[model samples]
Every structure is written in structure tokens, then in C-alpha cells.
Target: MNLFGKFATVGGATLLSRVFGFGREMMMASALGVGPVADAFNLAFRFPNLFRRLFAEGAFNAAFIPLFARSLESDGEGGAKRFASEIFSTLFVVLTTLTVLAMIFMPTLVRTIIAPGLAVCVDTVDTGRQAISCETRFDLTVTLSRIMFPYLACMSLMAMVSGILNAFRRFFAAAVAPTLLNIILIAVLLYAHWVGADTVTIGHLMSWGVLAAGVSQLALVVAAMRLAGFSVALGVPRWTQNLKRLLILAGPAALIGGITQINLFVGQAIASFKPGAVSILQYADRPYQLPLGMVGVAIGVVLLPELARALKAGHLREAQHTQNRSLEFALFLTLPAAVALFLIPEPIIRVIYERGAFDPTATPAVASVLGLYALGLPAFVLIKVFSPGFFAREDTKTPMRATLVSAVANTVLSFVLFQFYAEQGIALATTLAGWLNAGLLFLGLWRRGLWEIDRALVKRGALVLLASLAMGALLLVELHLLSDWLVPAAGLHRQLAALAFLVASAMAVYFACTVLFGAVDRSMLMKLAKGRRGRAKAAE
Candidate 1:
């Protein structure tokens, strides 16, 4: 399989996971609503997820994959296996210790980092109607965070295994592993909803489900490793030179990840000050995350190892071509999704989440945030494309510096804007931060002579943007034409049908415009498709 083929494999799997994630979110909105329980649960979930992103997905993958791939090239399978086992043992020890410490200090974490707003609410004398006491919410968040903190350990180890798999060019199992998370949560939500459980019971059940999903996801990926004839046995931890070197590289990358998470944490903390804002932002995030995950994540996961191997083999031109193609492909899909989200977030939000206990009032807020988030979608994906330029070369500090600047800007912007625009301000701050991060990463790559946009990429990119705008224009008219069926009074099925039609029409118009405007290279796409088919036939 080719690079884009590998991207499709990962992206297709990611799309499935994102769809299931949407289902899980919809069920969650119905089960908990944008209430105290919802706020608490979302905040708690974000806690472990924040660290998982910081340590495992962010720093670990960035640092591990290049070294692992180099080991494979220089030392063969035997040496690579030893390296993997050494890293695995060391990671296991550190993560286990961190998880225990986090659980032990869960209350402090909740009060300080997770949701200080909840702590403030707990202290304030309520002067308004309160469904649940602030103290109760704070306690619930702490408990839930403790229940799910172990998920970090599970996911961190899973990420190590995933890095190994990606180094081996086996993308499917790792890409598909996330689906187990959504699948497990959906099942738990379904059961809870069927039994008509209260929000508190549902919250507890869901937290447990998250931990279970973490374990299940790890198991699936490890099983994939074994089947691929790649197994790392965890022995006593060692401080080998390679382990020391891995930590040295991962340290800066970890800071970069931490900086990124701090941006998010700041936004979440400020949003927590407003009732239901955290849940509302989360609802809006799901829409944009679909494209980001499918394109950005797939590109990041596939591009890094590919670039690492190419650069290691002194194939500089191949590395540059890979980067260009990855960027072009990312924008081609991401631009249209961003345009749609910006143009018609209300209807999309309504169709997906404006059911059950999800209030109609929250739809406008979610839509507003989603639209702002849409503005940064391309930049977010670009970061994925450009960061690998540095990471694949074992240059982690450059992105770290870039992220630090963005993080500081985001923190300041969120603080200044939140007082006026509320959650929308936070969203705008995040978007601006994303663009800043992307810009810095790109500039770093260009100035360092590591990357450049060839004319073909630039021409095709402008055409893709043009095509996306055309689709957005057509979508506006389509939405107006279908407004009758798309309205809330039209009922769920009618609204759903109308939304689906609009999406399908938008897709048709966009691809048609891309072809008509010569935005995509038809011959290359054809070749890729033919290659895929040939490979399938051979396997059969």
C-alpha cells in the first residue's frame, strides 16, 4: 500500500470511531443533559484525557517512533525488540507511579487544575435556583476523576505499542483501537438509558465504562502486536543509554504536549465558570473533531513514521514529497468540512444533539462555538502535517518553542475575551491559538530548509479552497431550500433526512467543483485506486 493508501486505512477507521463517538455524545446528552452531572462527568473525563494526550499520544509517539524506526533500520528486529522492551518497562513503571500519585491527590487536582470554578462555586453562597449543590458537583468530579485516572496508564502503554506498530507500517489495528472506547461507552450509555437511571448513576456507570474501554483498547492493540510477531516483554526497569536518550528527547516533546494541554485546560477552566459551558463546548467540538481526527490524526500517525524512515535512509526528496502530499491531502478534506461547519453549524448541531434533555437554548451557543472552531480547523490539521517535519528529524524543541508561544497567547486571549464573549470567546481564543501554532510550525520548517510548498501544491491548494467555498455557497442555498424539513418542528427523522441530503449535496457539489476546477489530479487518484484494488485482489 502507498502513503495515501495507508492514510485512508487509518482515516477510514478513524471516521468509524468518530461516528461512534457522535453516537456516544448524543446518548450522553440525552442521559445527562447540560446539567451538573454532565459538567462534572465531562470535566472528569477531560482530566485523564488531557494527560493521555500530553504523555502518550503527544510526547511518547513523537519521541518513540523515529528512534524505533531508526532501530529497525540500523539494528534489525532483534535490537529493535530489545529497545521496545526497555522503553516499555520504563514507561510502565513511570506511568503506574504517576497514576497512583494522581489518584491520591485527586481532590487537589480537581480544585486546582481540573475545575477551579467548581471549587469557587462550592464556596460561594448560592443566590439563585440550583439543581445540584456546587459542593456535590465538585465531589462528583473528584470521584469520577479518580475512577478514570488509571485510564492514563492503560492508554500510555497502548500508545507505546501503537508507536511500535506504526514503525512497522501496520496502521489498521492502532487506528481501529479507539473505536473500542466509543463502543464500550455507547453500550454502557445504552444500558443506563434503557434502565432509566438517574444522571448520577449514569455518570458513575460511564466513568467505569471509560476505564474498561481503556483496558479493552490496550488489549486489542497488544494483541495486534503479538499477531504481527512483535512482542515487548516488560522486565525490570533499566536506565540504558537509549532509555536516557529517549527521555531527553521526550522531555521537550512532553513540554510541548503539556503546553498544548494547558491551552485546553485554561479554556476548560474558564468555561467551567459558566454553567453548562464545558458541556456546550464539548458538544460543538465533536463536529470539528470528525474532520480533524480523520485527516489530521491519520496524517500525523502515518506521516511521522514514513518521514522518519525516509530521512533516516537519506531520502530527503522523498521526505519532502511526503510532507507536501500530506499537507495537500489534509487541506483538501479539512477545508470543506470547516466551510460547512462555519456555514451551517446550527442545523448540524440541531440534527445531532438537540434531542432528549438537550435544551434548545444550548443549540445556539454550541453552534456559535462550532462556527468559530471551524475557522481554525485547517490550521489545526496543518499543525499535524507540519509538526512531523520536525519530529521525524528528531527536532522536538522547535515545536516545543512554537507551542509555548501559542500557549501563552491562548491563555492571555482566553482571559481577556472570556469576560465579554463567554464560551465563544474561549473558542475564538483556541482557534487563534491553533493558527498561531500552525504558522510557527510551518515557518520553522521553511526557515530551516526542511519543507516548502511546490507550485503544484500551491495551485491545487488554492483550487481546493475555491471548491470548498463554492460548496459552502451551494450549501447555503440548499439549506434554505430544505429549511422547512430541516426545522426543529419538522421532527427528528425529517430533520435528519434533510441534513443528510444537504451533506450529500454539498459533497457532490464540492467534488464536482474540484474536478471541474482541476483542483485534484485525476490521474494520481486513479493510480492510487488501481493500486488499492490490485493489492486487495492479491490478498484474496
Candidate 2:
């Protein structure tokens, strides 16, 4: 598919999933609010999510894509299926074992890794600007974490299956798999509320819902992969060149490329002590994930195959060009998003999540973290897009080394920043780490002279950045003008209108200014705007 069509196909599916997720969060905020119960739910879910990214999206994709593409290229459909079957079978056993271990060690694990959740139990709970006993916070976290812990097993399996499906060129079911998760969560929340489930029991109900979402997501993706003519079996393991290759690549990929997520886990740990910190991070993560999911994941998935093919054919120039173009697209798209989030995240969060359990105080706090996250949005996307450059060339060590640097930087920054800014500081630290990672990657590639942005790309990038800044300024003006109409100081109606105005004005201003200044290439913009579609950056 052309870049635009592929983005639309993948991004559209992602957008649907994110919107459903937003709905789920909305329901959650209404029911849970920003309290200990909410923290428990967030804490419980993140463990599974952390592992899910490790095994499914970030780490799994890093290893799976190159191997899948290679299998398909050299061995045809039959070869690819056999390879997938072998890996799938082994993965099942591994994940099953891992799940049991996690459950058995859940408490100890939480204490060690997510210790803040445990510590919160010893501290006071912030119950709407008031303090409650530490036992309440700790007990809530412990119970909820236990209930939702099984989701790790379910989602890990789901991610493995999704990788297989993507290899089979079946993107839709896997792409939409997350929608089921969000949908299930939404339904559970709505039902629980409608039936007037006791407030005390809502945390327990939500934990079960988290588990349900995991099972549904895993089962759906596995079924789709099976229907796509691939199956996994837990057969006796044997050494294979492909398996060995995957392991060799995967180890470093996970170590290096997956550092960002590791830092997130770190952030989670650090944020645990602060009241409502975990929930605030989760709320902010929603919008931050939108662009990351759409562009970053899509590019990582698509470009690796393309680059692997080119590299396998000894087409270095083609691979290099692809990297450059994808980087440009990522930078072009994400820069503006960063600016927008930094400037007007309050209205965005207010419109999307400021009802039910999510209150006004929660809005700006969440928005503040979102802004912090936005600072690294472009880098986050770029890392995913550019990573295959190293991976496709069978060089994972450099990225791995860079990742180690970033992980340390992230950890150090978290400790230092948390002392000052609390929850948002942890987020900002993560953003700083990401920018460092991206800078290092680009510098590495440049040192090897593998990535080059010619004068055209440089000029184009400048135009995009300049125009984006113009758009940002326009938003600053319109936001103040539309403040009363957007959220005002009170009432739902005014808040709703104010939000609509903020969105419309921002869109009008950004598009108008960028289009006028020729930020996006005019010809390309028209083609893309008209839905003709073209290659856009993978990471953004």
C-alpha cells in the first residue's frame, strides 16, 4: 500500500482502538475517580501492559518482523508457517511458565519492582485533598494488583499471536484486537455503574474486567492468526538457524530498543508513592500513545520488512533513503503534536476524560504530564522508525548500548526530577531520556554515514518546524479567546463548547498556517489531503 493508505488503514484502526480506550477511561474516571482504587487499577494493569510491550509490541515486533519477512522471502508461505509454528509453540510454553511465576511471586514482585504501591499502603491516601490511612492505599493496591495480574499471561500470548498474524499479512484483526480490550472495559464499567455496584466493590469488578480484556484480546488475535493459515504448537524444541538468529537479535533489541518502556516501569515505581500519581500517568499516557501507536508502530512494522528486503538484496541506498524519508515524516508530523500538547492539553484532556471519576483537578495534572510526554513524542516515534535501520543490518549492539545509556539517564533523571516536580517530573525525565536516545541513534547513523537528509529534506524540515511554530502561536491566541467557550471556569455546557472551539480553532490555525507557508509540500499535501495517500513516517 502507499504510505498514506497504509497509515490510514493501520492508523484508522488504531484511532478506533484509542477512541474506544478513551471511552473506557472515561467510564473508569467516572466510576473510580482519581483515588486509591484508581491507583490500584492503574498499577495492576501496567504490569501486564509492561510485559505486553516487551513480548508483544516492542520486543516481539523487533525480532518477529525481520524473521517473518526473511522466512517469507526465502522459504515462501510454507517456510514462514513452519518457522512461526516452531516459535509460537515455544513462546506458549515460555509465557505459560512466566505467567505462573508472576502470579506466584505477585506480592514479592510488586514489593520489589512496584514497591511504591506497597509503600503507599504505609503512607496516607490523598482522598480528594485529604489524607487517609496508609493501610487503605496498600490494601487496595495489593488486592487490585492480584486480581489483574493474570492479564500479563493473557496479553503476552495475545502479543505473540498478533506478531504471527502480522507476518501472515493479516493486520486488521490484530490491529483491532486492542479495541476488544477497551470495549470490554467500557462495557464492564457501564454495566457495573448501571446496576449500582457498590463503590467499595468497583475496584474488584474492574480488576476482573482487566483480566477479561486480556483473554479476549489474546483469543481474538490467536483465532485470527489461525484463520490466516498459521498455527502454533508447543512441540519439543530444537535448534534452528532462524530461531538462533531471532534470539540473537531479540536479546539486544529488548535491551536497547525497549529501554523506553523499561523507563516507564521505572516511572510507575517512582510515581507510586505520590497520591493519584499512577492514575495521572495513565490518563496522560492515553493521548501520548495515540500518535505513538499510529505512526511509530505502523512504521516499525512496515519499514523493517521493506528495509530487510532491501538490505538482503544488498540495496544499501534504498534502505538509507527509506530511513531518511521515514525520519522526515516522523519529525514533520510529531513536532506539531508536541507543540499542541504542550500548549493546550488541558482542553483535550477535559473534553475526553473530565467526567465521572475524573475531576477538574485531575484534568490539568494529567494534562501537565501529557505535555511532558509530548516533549519526547517525536523522539519516541523516531526511535521506532529508525531502529530497523540497525536491526535490518543485523547490528543490534549499538542500539542496545544507546539504550543502556538512555535507561540509566531515565532512571537518574526520574530520581532527581521526582524530588522536585513529583509525578510530572518523572514523565519529563522519561521525555528527556527519549530525546537522548533519538539523538544518539541519529548520531550513530550519521557517524556510519548511513543516514543522510539532503538539502531538500533539510529545507522541508525547516519549513515544517517553522510552520508548526506559527501554528503553535496561533493556538496560544485562540486558546485564550476560546477559553470561556471551551471549559470556562465552571459547568459542563461551557466546558463542552470551549473544548470544541479549542479543537476547531487549533485545526484551522495549524492547517491554514502550514498550508500557507508550504510547510507540507503543497503537491504532497493536496494528494494526502484528498486521501490519495503516500508514504508518511512510520514512527509518528
Candidate 3:
């Protein structure tokens, strides 16, 4: 299928997952809120999620998909399957060993790296009216981390299978796996609520749910791989030449992932010192992630495979065109989202999370963080777009070096900022670091002559920015006019109505401005749709 079609398939599935993820977060906010249990759970969950991103989503795919795609292109089905089996066996062994080791040392991991602040006793004032003790939170985080670490192993293997499927141009199943995770977590939340479980108990159940979700997600992609006419079976580990090359690429990719995740770990560790700070940051982060996951990740997933295939077949022009259009498409969606998040964060956070245990007083802090995060949204999406230019060419070292700079910036800034601005300062540091990372990646791609921006793309990007600014202006006006209607005192129905109107109005203004400015046209969209169908037919 065409790039746009593949993106739609992946983005649509991701959108569904993000929607359900919102529901899951809403339930979590109600059930746990910004309490000690919530803080502990977020920290615990971060352990496995950190590795999952490092191994499964980030490094493994960066190393695996391109090679897997090239194998299919040159060596055909048998060669591709053999390569996949070797990688799968090696990945399974490595991840399993890592998970076991991590689980065994969960307490040391938590104490040393994850959330050392949990060790100290805090005064009641520091506890912020939450009765759960710091020591209790510390113990619970260790236990929950142990419970969830196995998920990393499951998901890493699952990611390899996903890479195989993506190589085969099968995006649906892998795209939908995350939705299953949200679904399972939501179910566990509901069941816990029904059972009248305590917050700590609910947290424990949720961690277990993560492991279960991993298994379910792995089973799903495995089934998808089989259905796509590839059988990837478990075998003893082997150190073949292909495996050596994969390891060579994967080492830097993994380091890059590690560096990037360290930024998050630093932010969270700093946030953990204050009660409810981690949960507050998490709540603020979820809304912006909707667009990021839907657009950025979808573009990254589809773009990498597409670029790999093009470059493999010696189609440099095709690769460059794909990169440009992907960037344009990403900016077209991401700019408006950044504007909305920056301008109306309070209303968005209040509407989604203010109910239940999420305190009204916490709204301002969460909203501020959300707005700061929005400032970096475009940078985040651009990273997704541009990094593929290097990864597809097996140039992982450049991004790793760039990530190291950003990581150091993030780590130093996070500490420096937290001393003054607290959680919001850490959020700001993350935003600035993201922009730095994107800039470095872009410069590297341009220097290597891999990325070229045409006049049309620049004009469209300028128009998108202008349209987004216009939308932001409209949103400020709407929020001012309906300010009272967005508050908790306005009741849920009124708040929902005002939010809906604001979103609809913003979308209308942005789209209208885009058309007027000649950024995008109906004919272009129709042609894209037609091209998608033609490509799909050709694939069949």
C-alpha cells in the first residue's frame, strides 16, 4: 500500500488504542488519583515500560525491521524466515535473561535508580493529605516492578514478530496490540473497583494486568505472523553473521533508546521527591501523547519500512519523497494539537481528569506541565519523521551521539530545574531537550545528504504553522467566552459540551485556514486516496 494508506491503517489503530488508553487513564485517575499508590504504580510501571521502549519498540525495531525487509527483498521467503528465527531466538534468550536478572534485583533497581525518594520518611505536610507512608510506597514499587518486569521479555519478543509482520507490509495486527493492553488494563481496573479493592491492591492487580497484556499482545502478533505466511518458531540461540550485524546495529540503537529513556527516568526520579508529583506529570502527559502516538509513532513505523524497502531497491528519490510527505503529514496534524494543548490545557485536563480523586487544586500544575509539553510536541513528531532517514541506512551511531547530548542536557536540566520550578521545571527541561534532539537529528540527516526539504514542503509547513496559530487564537477567544462553562462548578455536561464545541471550532478554523492558504486541497486528498487503493490492488 501507499505511505498514506499504511499510515492511516496504523494511525487509525493507534487512535483507537489512544482512546482506550484515555479511558484507562481516566479510570486510574478516579481509582488512584495523585496519591502515594498512584505515584508508586507510575514508578513501578515505568520500570518495565522503560525497557520495553528501549528493547521492544525503539532499539529492536530499528535494528530488526530494515534488515528483515532487506532480507525479504534479496533472499526471498526462506531466507527471511531463517533470519527472523535466528533474531527471535537470540532476542528471546537475551530478554528473558535480562528480565530475570532485573526481577531478582528489583529492590536495588528501585532504590538506586527508579525512585530513591521513596526511602525517606516525609512529614504529613509533605504527604499532602494522602495517608499512605513513603516506606509503604517504596516497598510496593519494588514488588510491582518485579511483577511487571516479565512483560519486558514478552514484549521484546513480540516486537521481533511485529518487525517480521511490518516487513511483510502487515501493519494492522501489530498496530492493534496496544489497544489490547489498554483493554486488559481497563478490565482489571473495573474488576478491582467492583471488588472494592484498596488502592495498593488495585495497583498490584494493574501490574499483573500488564504482564497478562504482554502475553496477549505477543500471541496476537504471532498469530498475525502466521497468517501472513511466515512461521517464526522458538529455537536455541545462534550467533550467525546476520545476528552479528543485527547486534552491531542494535547495540547503538539500544544505547540511543537507553539515553532517551534516561531523560524520562531523570524527570520521574526528580518528580518522585514530592508527593503526587509523578502522578501529576503522568496525567498531564497522557493527553499530548494521543496525537504523538497516533501521528508520530504511526509515521515512524510505516516510514522506516517504506524507506528501507525503497533504499534497498536503490530508489533514493522514492525514499526522499516518502520522508518529505511523512514530515508534512505529521506536521499537518501535530501543529494543531500542540496549539490546542498549549492554549487550553486547563479545560482539557479538567474535563478528562478532574473528576473523582483528581483534586481541583492540582489542575493548574498539571495544566502548566501539559502546556510546556505542548511546546515540544512538534519537535517530538519531527524526531519520529527524521530518525528513519538514518535508521533505514543502518546509521544508528549518529542518532546515538545526538541522543547522548540530549540525554545529558535533560539530566542536568532536570536536576537544576527541579530545585526551582519543581515538576513543571522538569517538564520544561524535557521539552527543551526534545527540541535539541530533533535539531541534532535533522542536522545529521542533512549533513549526510539524506534529508532534503523542497519549496512545496516548506510552504505547506509555513501554512500549517499559520493555520495552527489561527486556531490557537480562536481557542483563546472561545475559552474566554466560555470560561465559566469549562469549570468543575459548571457540571460535567456543561464542561463536556464546552470542550466539544471548542475542539470542533478549532478543527474547523484550522482546516478552513489550510484550504484558504492552499496548504492542502481536496484534489490532493482524492488523489492520495486513489493512489492508496491502486497500491493496495498492486500488492494483492
Candidate 4:
């Protein structure tokens, strides 16, 4: 398949997963609302997920895929498998050790890092109605963190397996494995709601569900690995020269790769000072993540391997083409989505998460946060597009420096902003930090002669922006037209229909505008379609 074909393979699966994720979050909002248990659960889940991203999916994959591709090219399948097994054993040991330590120190992690505000909230006299004691929230977070910490081990191993699959160009299983997490959690939430479980019970069950999903996801990719005629043996961990080199690359990549997570962590920490702020941010996050996951994550996954192979073969022109196309693809999809999110956050949030325990009063606050996050959506995807340019060349330190600068800016801004604007301020800080990071990454590549904006990309980029603005204008008009159906007082079905119509209209308008304005190359799209038809004929 071609690059766009590969992107579709991964992005389509991610779209499925994100759709399921929306279901999961909607259920959580109904069952748990923005209560103390919901807050605790969100924090506990993020704790393990933070580590998973930092150590496994983010840093490990950034450093691993290029080297793994190199192994496959230079060392043959046997040598590549051996290399994978060695790396797998080492990853298994390291993550296991980290999980144990994290579980043991759960309270400290919660008190100091995860949600220190819980401790402080316990001492503050509630001048308002108290749904649950702050003490309970603190203890619940610690308990849930310990219960789910083992998920880190499972997912980290899964990441290594996924890297192996991506290197081999078998993208589907690795891409689809994440859906299990959402599917499992959705099932758990359904059960919890059906049984009429309390918030605390639901939180505990969800934690266990997370652990189960991790195992299921790992099993899936491992099975895929075997089916692909590849296997990694589990043996004693060995410290080889490759391991040392991996550490050197991953050490910096960890921070650089996890910059987005780190920024979220900072926001979570600061948002913790206010009740329900974490869950609010998380709710706002889900809508924007759909586009980011579909476009940014998919492109990043496919682009890195494609770029690495191109550069490895000394095909500099091919590498440049891959980078430019990836950037064009990212902006084309992301800009319009960002526009929609920014323009209609309230309606989106209301439709997705406004029933049951979720108070209608919180809708505006969540919408505001969502809008600020939307402004940074394109920046977030741009980071994904550009970072692979460096990673494919095995340079992690440059992005790491940019990430550190962004991280510091986010931390300082979040701290100052949270004091003033609360959750929205934190959201704003993250957005600014993302743009800063994306700008620096882009500049680094351009200055180092690693990447340049070709004329096609520049032309398409301008058109994409123009089309996005046109879509935004139409969306605002749609919102006005559908105001009656989108209101909080409207029935769920009406709201759903209205939001669906809005989305359909927005997509239609954006596509029409892009095509009319020549933002996309019709000939390239035709080539992709022809390739698909040829593949189908071959299969027949």
C-alpha cells in the first residue's frame, strides 16, 4: 500500500477506537458525573497512563522504530527478531520494576504528584455543600492508583510489540489494539450503570477494567506478531550495546515524546485545586482527541517508519516528500476540526456529556476549556507531523530541548493562569505551550536543513486555512439555526440529530471548499483510488 493507504488503515482503526471512547466517556459522565469519585478515578487512571505514555508508547517507540527498521534492513529477519526479543526482555524487566515501585509508593505519588490538592482539600472547611469528604477522595485515588499501576507493565510490553509490527508494515493489529481499552471500559461502565453501582464502586470497577484492557491489548498484538511470522522470545534481560544506545536516545526522547502528556499532567495538577476541574478538562479533551488521534497519531505512526526507511535508503527526496505530505495531511484534517470545536464546543459537550450526574451548570465552563484546547488542536497535530522528521533521523535531543522549553512555559503559565481563570486558564496555558513547541520543532528542522516547506505544501497549507475559516463561518450559522435543538432543555435525540447534522454539514462544506479551491490534488487522490482498485483486482 501507499502512504495515504497506510494512514487510512491506522486512522480508520483509531476513529473506531475514538468513537468507542466517546461512548465510554458519555457513560462515565452519566454514572459518575463530576463527583469526588469521578475526580479520583480520572486522576488514578491518568497516573498509570502518564507513565505508559512517557516510558512506553512515546519514548520507547520514538527510539525503537528507527533502530528496529535498521535491524530489519541490515541484520535480516533472524537478527531483527533477536534484537526485538532482547529489547522486549529488557522492557519487561524495567516496566515491571517501575510498576512495583510506583505501587509501593502510591500514597506519595498521589500526595505529591498525582493530586496533591486532595490533601489540601481535606483541611479546608467546605463553605458549600460537600458531596464526599476530601479525605475519601485522597484515599480513593491512592487505592485506585495501586490497583491500576500494573497496567503500566502490560501496555509498555504492548508498545514494544507494536513497534515491531509497525516496522514490518503490519499496521492494523497494533493500531486496533487500543480499541480494546475503550471497549472493555465501555462494557464495565455499562455493567456498572445496569447494576446501579455507586460512584466509588464504578471507579474501582473501571480501574480493574483498565488493567484487563491492558492485558487484552497486549495479547492482541502478540497474536498479530505470531500471525505475521514473527516472534520474540521471553528470556533473561541482557544489557547489550544496543540497550545502551536505546537508553541514550530514549532518555531524551522520553521527555520530548511525552511533552503532550507532561503538559496535560501539569494542567491536571493545577486543575486539582478546584473540585471537578480534572474531570471537566478530561471531558473537554475527548472531542478534540478524536481528531488528534485520527489525524495526528495516525500520521505520526506511519510517517516515522516511512521517513526512516526513505532516509535509510539514502532517498533524501523521498524523505522530504513523506514529511511534506504528512504535514499537508495533518493540517488539512486538523484545521477544520479545530474550527468546529472552537465554534460549537457547548453543543458538542452538551450532546456528549450533559445527562445524569453531569450538571447542566458546568456546561459553559467545559465548553470554554474545550474552545481553548481547540485553538491548540492544529499545533498539537503539527508537533506530531514535525517530530517524526527528527526521530526518523535518530535525533531525539533537539526535540527534547524544545519540549523542555515548552514544558517549563506550560508549568509556569498553568500555575499563574489557574490562580486567575481556574480550568480555562490552565487550558489556555497548554495551548500556548503547544504552539511554542510546534514552532520550535518546525524552525529546528528548517534551520538544520532537515526539512523545508515545498511549494505544494505552502499552497495547500494556505488553502486548508482558508477552507477551515469558511467551514467555521458556516458552522456558526448552523449553530444559530439549530439553537433550539441544541439547547440543554432539548431532548437527547434532538440534540444528537442536530449535532450530527452540524457535523455532516461542516464536513461537506469543508470538502467542497477544499476541492473547489484546489487545496487537495485531485490527481493524487485518483492515484490512491486506482491503487486500491488494483489491490482489489490482485486479491481477486
User: Which candidate achieves the best TM-score against the true structure?
Assistant: 4
Off by over 4 Å in 2: 124-133, 487-490, 525-540
Report the lDDT of model 3 for residue 174: 86
What tens digits encode model 3's per-residue C-alpha lDDT throughout 53-161?
A: 6665546788888788778878998888889888888878887888888888888988888897776647432333346666677888899989988888887888788
Clashes of 4: 0
Q: Which residue window of length 10 is worst by lDDT in model 4?
A: 122-131
lDDT of 2 by residue, 1-540 (tens): 565455557667777888888788777877777887777777777777777666655466677777887778889888887887777677677767877777777777777786555654556655553455767666666677777877777776676677777665566776777788888888888888889885457778878888888888888887887777777666876678878888888888766656667888899888887778888988888888888877776676667767777888998887777777777777777888889888888888887777765777788899899989998999888888768778777889898888889999999999999999999899999999998998898888889977877765787678878877887888888877776666635677777777666657766776776667666667876676555332344333
Best-fitting candidate, scored by lDDT: 4
Reference-based TM-score of each model? 0.96, 0.92, 0.95, 0.96
Model 2: lowest-lDDT 10 consecutive positions: 531-540
Runs off by more than 4 Å, candidate 4? 55-58, 123-130, 531-540
TM match of model 4 to true structure: 0.96
Supply the global lDDT for candidate 2.
0.77
Which lDDT value does model 3 have at 250?
A: 85
lDDT of each: 0.86, 0.77, 0.85, 0.87
- Model 1 clash pairs are none
Q: Indicate the worst ten consecutive residues by lDDT in candidate 3.
A: 121-130
Which stretches of candidate 3 lie above 4 Å from their native place? 55-58, 124-130, 255-262, 528-540
